[model samples]
Target: MRNAMWMQGVEWLAAAASDPQACKREWERGAGTVLLEAGRHWDVVSVPRQLGLLALDILWYDPLRTPGPTLVDSAAHRVGFFVPPDPAGNWAGADIRRASKGSWVAVPPPYRSAGSVEWIVPPDGSGTLHPPLTLELALRQANKTLAVLAPVSAD
Candidate 1:
C-alpha cells in the first residue's frame, strides 16, 4: 500500500520527465520538476542524508491509484526534494555511482511521522531514460514502491 504511493509518485515523475522541457531540465539539473500534488499540502520539509537531500512536502492528498501507482490529477500541491546534490555541481544522472540517502518527514500537527524514508538510486549505469530510475536502497524501498506502485509484484 505504502509502496504503491511512492511508485505512483515515480511514475508520475517519469511521465512528467517525458516532457522535453522537464527532461532537459532533469538532464541539466540534479533535481527535476515534478507535478506531485495532494488535495492539500500538509507541510513541506527536507529529507536529509550524507549523499544528498530531497524535499518532501506533505500534500493533503493520497496517490490516485494505489495498490498500483497513478498520480491524482486533483491532489493538493507542494514541492518535495528527491536528492541532496549541489545546486551548483553537475546534476546527478546516469553513470553516477554516488547514491543519495533520503530521510522521512511528517507534515502538520502529527506528533510523529506518517510516510517512510528512502535512498533514491538511479539505474546501475543507465540514465538515458531508456531505463527507469533504479533504486539500490533497501528491500524496504522496493517493497514500499511495489506495494504502492503495483508493478513490482507483476513479475
Candidate 2:
C-alpha cells in the first residue's frame, strides 16, 4: 500500500512531462532521470547549491513552512525548487535561474536520491507546490545569511 501511494505521487509529477506515458516507461526501464517541460504544471527556480541548502534549511525548520518538491543536481552544483506557474515570470536573483514556459528540467524518480540529479523533496501526490512569495522570502533570507557567512577579501 505504501509503495502504491508513492507511485501515485510520482505519477502526479510525471504527468508534467510532454509525454507522461513515455516518462513513466523511462523510469520503468531504470532511467536515472527524465527531462520534463516547465510552466505547464509548475515552474522551477534553481539556485546555487550553497544558497539552496540554506534556503531549504530555513523552509524546513518550520514544519508548517515545508516547501514543495525540490531537486538537487550535484553535477551542476545547483538545486531546483518547484513552484506554481507564473505567467509573468517575475523572478530575479544574482545566481538564480527560473525555468518557466519554454524551459526544461531534469527530474529524478521520487524514490531515487543517489545520482547526478536527485530529489531533495519529492512531491506528495496532492499537487502541492511552494508558494512563490514564501519561496522568495526564504531565498532572500538565505542570501542574506550567505552574505554574512562569506569570507571577507583582504585588500
Question: Who wins the TM-score comparison?
Answer: 2
What is candidate 1's local distance difference test score? Answer: 0.25
**What's the TM-score of every candidate structure?**
0.17, 0.92
lDDT of candidate 2 over 43-119, digit per residue (tens): 99999999998998889877765678898999999989999997344468788999988998888778776478888
The residue ranges of model 2 lying beyond 4 angstroms of the native Cα positions read 87-90
Q: Give the per-residue lDDT of model 1 (tens digit) for 90-141.
A: 3333222222223222121111112232223221111121101221232224
Candidate 2: residue pairs that collide: none
Poorest 10 consecutive residues by lDDT, candidate 1: 65-74
Where does model 1 exceed 4 Å of error?
A: 19-155
lDDT of candidates 1 onward, in order: 0.25, 0.85
Provide the clash count, candidate 1. Answer: 18
